[model samples]
Target chain A: MDSFVLPSFISPNSEDIKRRIYARIRSDLHRIEAEIDRNINSSIPLISVVARHIMGSGGKRLRPLLMILSSRLCGYTGDRDVSLSVVFEFIHAASLLHDDVVDHAEFRRNQPAANTIWGNPGVVLVGDFLYSKSFLMTVGYNNIRILEVLSSATTKMAEGEVLQMVHSDNLEVDEEEYLEVITRKTAVLISAACQVGAIFGGASPEEEEALRAYGHHLGIAFQLVDDTLDYTGDVKELGKPVGNDIREGKATLPLIYTIKKAKPSVKKRLGEIFCAEEILPENFLEVREMVMRSGGIEYTLHSAIEHVQKAKESLDIFPAHPTKETLVEIADYVLCRRV
Target chain B: MDSFVLPSFISPNSEDIKRRIYARIRSDLHRIEAEIDRNINSSIPLISVVARHIMGSGGKRLRPLLMILSSRLCGYTGDRDVSLSVVFEFIHAASLLHDDVVDHAEFRRNQPAANTIWGNPGVVLVGDFLYSKSFLMTVGYNNIRILEVLSSATTKMAEGEVLQMVHSDNLEVDEEEYLEVITRKTAVLISAACQVGAIFGGASPEEEEALRAYGHHLGIAFQLVDDTLDYTGDVKELGKPVGNDIREGKATLPLIYTIKKAKPSVKKRLGEIFCAEEILPENFLEVREMVMRSGGIEYTLHSAIEHVQKAKESLDIFPAHPTKETLVEIADYVLCRRV
Candidate 1:
């Protein structure tokens, strides 16, 4: 996934770039939404209800958007692009459902999690339903490569989640271990999304590898930004609490960096708060102040921008097209998105 | 699945019958075990640990056994039977892991559940790993029908679980609704096992239909026996606690039958115990006795025997061989086996 970091300048006019990319892909995004709605329906009423509850909850659909734009960038002219885009959304949504259950998350997208409303069993099974549905959709295309990409991605994603659980609340987890977790848990699926689109577009192996690398760096950059935002983001914009990662005892990049840079006394204090039976509000606030004072957020943002620069560099091999421009703009957008 | 009831003489010597069937397939069963052991290994250590914990637990591997034996019945001579059988075991193990999490089950096969040891997040993610692994295995052979059968079965199984949850603790759930739940939850996967084997064995269309019917009926009978045993079997023999279905607020076939046949006062008492906030030991005993007096166990057993007979009858289309005889004996064994 090209894990080593390099520095680059962030685009100051990111809002204009984001709007331009959104305007270009606006129609395709709507088509992807339609396909998602149609595919989520089930004969069993509860499956539909629980699935729709999560599907309608406002995920940015970034994975599917990446897939569709990548397909277009590779000059895909077939009608299957929207259908294939549905596969990414289903996979993304299914993981979110299971993720919420695993994390015992109360709120998702500013609403109660599906587990809270339907109970854990129903939520878990619906996640299974969505997963199988994605596979079912894949078979209709008679494409073995798509199935291979998705199956491997899912296995790695699950492994990443289990690894995260093993590292949960451990104050000794290092940056390399944290990077491995995010790459497996987050980057692999996004990479698959872009690679599968290239395959469908009939891209050469070289083009496919370039797109895969692009997605890998962009995904890592995206997650690093998310981790930085956990300490610095507004609760209303983030759709959850500000210090949720602290409350959950997750050792994200910012927290890991903060622990590394803190004074000995502050390190012990942060570790006690992080490894506490329950992190009290005052302790959480103190940990947040310590992270900010240590310049953890800025350091994490610098790392994200490095990955984003690498992501844009991977796309330089492709010819200049509007779709290619949108892809680059989306990579830039990952660094600036609030939610 | 032959839902209608019929009277049949109980086999007086099931041990002899079970021995005969097991002796016929003993070699193939061992090979399936080896395949399961090989396939369950993973890059992430905890997946292997959690998977092995459940896979080594005392499941009879009934679904995979059906697949292997059915393939042999169709005169399969190749090694793909072992590989195909692994898919069934993986699917069944994945469902069991998720089931334990959903049920909050403390014990399975007289040992603590994976969720109890690893926590729900790890367990749920491992279940996902097994599922994706199964699909990954299927793609190696490039068989589309096998994928379709498995994908459809998994979707139906999830729907069945949600349907059962919807009908939980409801006295109004009828025999038909109960049949639907068991068919989707239990029978579809078993049917898929036999059908996939037939597909692999190069069976004719008529033979495939016959084998599919055989599997479907046998699965229903197997589940009916399980529901009856919930009320009447010994705890040690069952390998878990008795009356577990009742304690879990499940309305199995026996409970549905008893609710239909009970006297006015007995019905009220049973309802009180069932719908009570907490069912005490004495209350549980009363519910068991009332079910016995209402002939719920016998009625459910009769229903099971009828399905077993139908299962055996479905084999008439095939020419008689040792494998076919063993399949018939296996169906009869379903009527008499204790666990």
Candidate 2:
């Protein structure tokens, strides 16, 4: 796995791109998986059980990969990157645990949510444990700069969550507001992961900022793709039901765009659908068709593609290397992947 | 307030002791209060509203006071202590927010819980916000030791919560298990507050350890008194209903002690009461009377007194400064406070 070779050219197909990327990063991913497992061990059995139920359920390890790849690109050769990479995954998993409970989600990654399995109290506490553990692990690095980046990221993430909650079910959500929510909720942490990795790798200030920007753009693209999948992807492929965002009354970019371009009659119908006691399949299909007709899906994907371009362009400061190529490929994969 | 003098001797009455301590720490408490308010300000109006709803309600601010007093005892004469002390208060408030949601609590501090008024989602998000904000503030200090102490305390606190949840409603929970739970849940954070203060104050290793031990014993005594109050306190005085611990299926020290000593018939009745779907007031009264008859209340209070004694003894290394005297008074007040 350590001697794995990357394809010379980019693959257009999502599956092939993902397989190639996974093969190239397989060793790093395995170490990240093991580190995540080791870090979550607790004296209390329930914490470990709940943490594993969510974390072990086939996450893509995207954030950790970004951290590792960023470090490698910045010329890091130390063993600590693997352990430090786990910090991002822990923070990500912790947020997901809390999100599932807050959303009253029934399923996550094709399994019953941890909160549903263990009840909310245990799940909530385990989420807290993971969060604290992440910070504690960072402290072991003894880097104040890294701590600042990670802590600030968490603060923004929490505020982003509250912003999303406040806007849930409200039809007046605009593109700027939606971007603000996603930027704080998803992009900041990813950016932090890259920035911390850059610091660990002894990157110059310019190189660190470049990686931060790259992560930010990639994170936004990733979320935009995710939101688009809610309208376009198959449930089996995505590991979650389509139209879930709409079902939860979350006004993602696609919906926001569709509402802007929608005629008053169609807008009234969408308002009715969203305001209903429950959104039915027919209503979802009707909204989906309207969104397609309004070019909302294409607009969202186009925006994501633009962000991916920016993410790749941000790597211009670094000399061409296998790690940099892999990062660019990963950015492309984020845009193309079905899940 | 700076010129206020401590009482020459200890007061047996709780109110007198509390009055003297408050008078001595009144300025520090005011600064902490203002800092807490300033730190909670958020761009999202709802976040600020929900944070203020719970935080503006009456709180003893014991954790922050301990930190401030410990710093003072260690000869800290810096302005940052006021802001740093807010970190402990924020963490304490964050835990309370999540706890109320987990416990499905209707009232906190004689008012509707933040969860009840704002719904669990907003409350939970705000809790996360506070938790993240607390860590973010600690990062500004650029003190890795302080950050390490806080992160570890939070991790233990979360584990303690899960441990308590696992044991909830179980009839077989023993003294050792209960002590473990309280130590992590309550004592760890208090001890961290003191230790962080000591670190900031440039205390010697012996002085720092002394304060840490002082806080641990004081925290245990504080929780013991709180548990006893649940069985014997007035609703008006405690700011919540009595017997809440048992109602929530918590086996606190009083109930655990009572179970160990109760006769077979009484034990069976207690089990039946605990198992009931709804414990009527009559059931609570019967259990309270039984706990009293079995000397559970006295036993718990006696144990608290012992801890209080140890807590005072932990401070013997420090010279008898006014701040030291205030800390002693606060420890005594913990044993005597009704709420």
lDDT of each: 0.85, 0.89
Kindly report which residue pairs in candidate 2 clash with one another.
none
- Per-candidate TM-score against the hidden true structure: 0.95, 0.96
Candidate 2 chain B least-lDDT 10 residues: B1-10
Name the lDDT value of residue A328 in candidate 2. 94
TM-score of chain A of each: 0.95, 0.96
Model 1, docking class: medium
Error of 2 at B225 (Å): 0.3
Evaluate model 1: give its TM-score: 0.95
Please, what are the lDDT tens digits per residue for candidate 1 over residues B1-339? 112122346776868888888788789888888988998888789999999999987678888888887888888988888887888888888998999988889888878888999888888999999998889888886888778888888888888888888888888899999999999889999999999888878789988898899999999999998887777666776677777888888988888898898778877878888898877777777888777777888888999989998999999998879888888888888888777
Candidate 1 lDDT over A241-328, as tens digits, reads 7778888878998889988987899889887888888877787678878877787877888988899999999999998998888888
Cα distance off (Å), candidate 2, residue B208: 0.4
Which candidate number has the best TM-score? 2
